[model samples]
Target: MNDNLYEIFHNVYEYKDKDTNNHFLLTENLAPGNKVYDEKLIRIQNREFRTWNPFKSKLAAAIKCNLKHFAFCENSIVLYLGAATGTTASHISDICRRGMVYCVEFSSYAMQSLVSVCEKRTNMIPILADARKVEEYLAIGKVDIIYQDVAQPDQIRILKINSQAFLKSGGIAYLCLKARSVDVRKSNSRIFKEATQELEKDFEILEKIDISRYEKDHMFYVLRYG
Candidate 1:
């Protein structure tokens, strides 16, 4: 590892700014010189790294909170649900440079931005469709990972449906569950518990991280689909 860069996971690097003494989670820029969501970029040894903000990305928050399972690889085929404006999805595109990131978004407003981001990165495929309707994206085939960040009341059901449709056996999934979206009336703990129970029926819970510090009323789950 270079002195300025530390490999936290495959293609994921940690960069500490010398000026502010602030450490940042970074991914090698797959599309060099291109700004995704206006994230800061750094150059070291002729390589570019994009600072992944935890506040803007739940996966970055999970990593900052010590998430153990890092399943993304250079060749990972990812199905990213709720890829709003391609913020987190862009980072995954950097990590999985040799693979594919199928970005699904329901909102036309968000999809417009996602499409521009996809145009720059060849690995990311933007899909304008609802995540709950898996049949629309069945052409993507089985994927190595399913990343769901949808904020609907039936978020778990959406994940289950997509997992059954596209997730490969023993594949990994990163679920960013928004408790308030599930049930604003119920407590966050109660919503998390119920969601976990529902997920346990289809996936083995590998690691669970409470990311309320970065994203309020949200629970980040790393699971293995069997």
Candidate 2:
């Protein structure tokens, strides 16, 4: 079952039990072959997620599964950690037109292309730093969402720190965690379960889907502060 933006946020029943939406009408349209991927993203970064590996970021799978849950109002502030090469980040920037995107990438290797991408795009502030030291960027606080796509073992811990420091009271977040990154010996389900437990302490988990066909043994979990 593909989860659109609305289903991710509104239909989860964690926030509310009723399925008020018609499932036909859509406010945030992120359908494949839509203008979002074609016209807008190309205009902004001059490229989208073609050359860069989707194996790295899970947004493509998120879009494939229905990207509606990612919908946010205009002018929203998004904190993106592990923004490699600015490919997926470019797509997000296009979707969130008129919004502020604060991207944090630790590797200088990807930053080479990312810097060039950011030079042309506005509202994309690229901060080269380890996400563990997220306190450094908390000065620019109260973001609408925090997107964590890191390949580290302690991602949940870092996201909690960043969310407490930067995310607004009712803000949302997305975590694209590599289960193998945390525990290679354990099964994918085991790793995901542990990570989910860690995340449930602060936020309400809207959906936890297996994203192995499009990617690897990774899971894209949509969360929000309760």
Candidate 3:
């Protein structure tokens, strides 16, 4: 379990940030007669497209590490940054069953497709806006967790802004860092270290993993507000 989480952390950050398309939201190959889901809204071939938490995937590395501490409850609001096309965000919506999942996305092009898919559901809320400019809409309220999956060059800076304005103190956060987006010339460790330093200033980092086994080029970080 420890090894898997570490590998996933790296995998999620190694890929170049790109717009995603064609991937099924929550449809992954699972066991027969062992489907696990809450209330099903949409079905394909009589099977549900949701019901997958980290407990069943390489992305599950984040939960195993207890970085964001999402598994313990099904009732906290999560402010998701960079909800491109709502891929992983959809899975989060499944896990957060009773809670609200607010997806904050930027690309108007991506939002066009994402909004169409999201409007079909009730739990997920799509906000087409810049993550860096979170304060503008943060008046909504504090969030229990903030998931940062943006691909900007200044990932840490934007994260800090959201943490300050939206995240309630004592809440948790997950940072899915893409190495290519941060710095391709230096070693991945160096970039990770730099971001950790910035976060440690105000957060209590729980775990930092490689996660390369699940994602091609990426890293996943879990932190708790101090």
Candidate 4:
């Protein structure tokens, strides 16, 4: 394995030549000899590469689907809504090693798993609260990014509310729009267009990605706070 082939994205790494996948999110083995979500780990010169499974992570699938902008940076402070079990949150924490991720998950069961993930990752803070109620997390200050993946009919509303309360001016947000969740009866295209239009008032759509390859009926909307 040629380590030179691995491309760097903050703390993440993507191998240029790989049989299994095109892009991978690699992090320093925070827990030596341990794996999160049964992902593939490759160690080279004191660095470990975890296969960021797109099928398991909508953000990863969006990246694979040509997501043009990555808002997470070294100085980024993130508000992550619906961080179910911290699969993608773990990777976000990895990328924002110098920053932090406030992971909000409503389900008690999911929070249990997320808490476990937070135990190992110092950068991730697990909050067992509803995304709709941003005031619940008073400890969390303004954040550079807001990422939402809630599978609710009012998903766009949830994101808009959180973004308004938490997102800093000029901040970025990624909303994982589940078409079926919004309206099963309507066409996916119509739902996507309507949702995008709703968000235009508060956000500037940066990139729109179709992630059907890994997650069906899912669209990723990258937006910038206006």
lDDT of each: 0.93, 0.68, 0.65, 0.84
On TM-score, the candidate that comes out on top is: 1
Whole-model lDDT, model 2: 0.68
**Each model's backbone clash number:** 0, 3, 26, 1
> Per-residue lDDT for 1-226 in model 3, tens only?
2211112221221111134522222432122232333412334445433433343343454544444444323676889898877666666665566677888888998787667656665567889789888765775688888888887789988888898898888888888887778888988778887888888999998878776655545678778886
TM-score on alpha carbons, each prediction:
0.98, 0.75, 0.72, 0.93
RMSD to true structure for each model, in Å: 0.9, 8.8, 9.4, 2.1
| Two-way lDDT contest, 2 vs 4, winner | 4
The TM-score of candidate 3 is 0.72
Find the candidate with the highest lDDT and give its number: 1
Considering summed lDDT, which 10 consecutive residues are worst modelled in model 3? 8-17
Off by over 4 Å in 4: 1-4, 16-25
Error of 3 at 156 (Å): 0.7
For model 2, what is the error of residue 76's alpha carbon versus the real structure, in angstroms, after optimal superposition? 1.4
Cα distance off (Å), candidate 1, residue 6: 0.4
Supply the TM-score for candidate 4: 0.93
Candidate 2, clashing residue pairs?
4-69, 5-68, 5-69
